[model samples]
Target: MFVVPKPLRLLAALLIVGTTSANEPIKLYMPDAPPLTLHHYVGGHGMVGDVVLTALARIGKLTHIVAEPWPRAQIRVAKGKDMLIIPLSRTPERENIYTWIAPIMELERAFFSLDEPVTSFAQARQRYRRVGVGMGTAQVGILQREGFSNEQIVQLKLGENPAHLLSLGRIDAWFTGIPEALYIWEASAYREQNLRQSPSLASTGLYLACSRDCDAQLVEQLRNAINQLEHEGVSLLLRQAYLPLQPDP
Candidate 1:
């Protein structure tokens, strides 16, 4: 019987593991949330998507991204096997639903209005009659926790422009991530002078997450790749490139 040397055995084992990881199919589900992710964006993926794609490339993994409504995407990714979701907020409500790989960005939630900004959630509840929030977003839970009623929370469908709704007096305010609000404002025909952003309501890390029963090796590979990108300042540069500069709220 021929025995392989220990060093040779180790090298072979590593190569086999690497080959398997590289061949594994990774499907990343995302919504059309601008700045963070937009299917039709110049890169065919926005900031978070860019960061995720870069990480996948570094790990020598091939992935297909599916664009779906936020609610549908979340459900699909959470239920699918070994799949991934991008730019997902790692909220307490969603903490255990998925296997969180790594945070790609920090998202600050805020209230945007055409009038004076409310100083606090308490103030917002008192002053605003109806607040617009994206359907299936963490913002909905945030507002509910802040004592907002179902009537006060208007769940807007995908492609519903909060700014447009605010301008038309449909919703008294829009509660959303700052980067997304700023990106929408820049792209819309709305005037910056008219839009008012409240002080940050909450801050959370947006992550690249896999399905609950994700492959351990795949998670490790992607996590290391993401950490490397963050260390190299690639994440920061991607954010800067996508998010527009605006005055402090």
Candidate 2:
């Protein structure tokens, strides 16, 4: 029989307690939304994904992660998978749909075009023959609210590939977030062939939306974790990756 010292026994007990406390691994879904969440050559990590994983780490063990299409991710959550979706915009309609947790990140919507220059939403509405939109996304809500009928909208999965359609003249403008839109626009082969994007159109906040199946106490714990991160400037720390826009001289 092996005999352990009192201090060793106490440490062993603490380790067991800690292990038991972190029994279940939390699932997190990250869609491919560049600069914010994208799979680059270096790795499958971005500012939003990184910040979210950091925050969630404080609350629970994160695992079983997948970077899929946003619509699929939404469906998974809707089906009550034990997971968290990052950078989701919370609307009154979505409130009943998903259990609310801490806000993970924020994003501003923008329009990228290959046709004539657009100074504003109204101008883009009138000038563009077609607009690229992500199916079942908050951007769809914005365009629908602005009176863009289904016939006028070209739906695509969530990501900057919509901008490619725009550049191909398949659509006029791609509706997307500022950081992502700009990154894709700059990187687009069409831009190399001469395509351009207008300035940002609108700004919106994004949040972490958990499955409604999540326990209330768990949700509250995650929210507190987020609050702590915010208080400690975790958001500001993440901002370091987003270098300000500097025009080519």
Residue 224 lDDT (model 2): 79
Model 1: per-residue Cα lDDT over 1-249, one tens digit each: 111111212222232222224464578888888888867644436778777876776676666777788888898889888998988999999998999999998899999998889889999999999999999998999999889999999999998888789888999999999888888887787765578889997988999999998899989988998888788776676667677768455
Off by over 4 Å in 1: 1-24, 247-249
RMSD of each: 8.7, 8.1
Residue range 68-138, candidate 2, lDDT tens digits: 77888887886775578876888756778788787666677767665555778787777766788777678
Candidate lDDT values, in order:
0.80, 0.64
Instruction: Choose the strongest candidate by lDDT.
Output: 1
How badly does each model clash, as a count of residue pairs? 0, 0
Residue 179: error of model 2 in Å?
Answer: 0.6
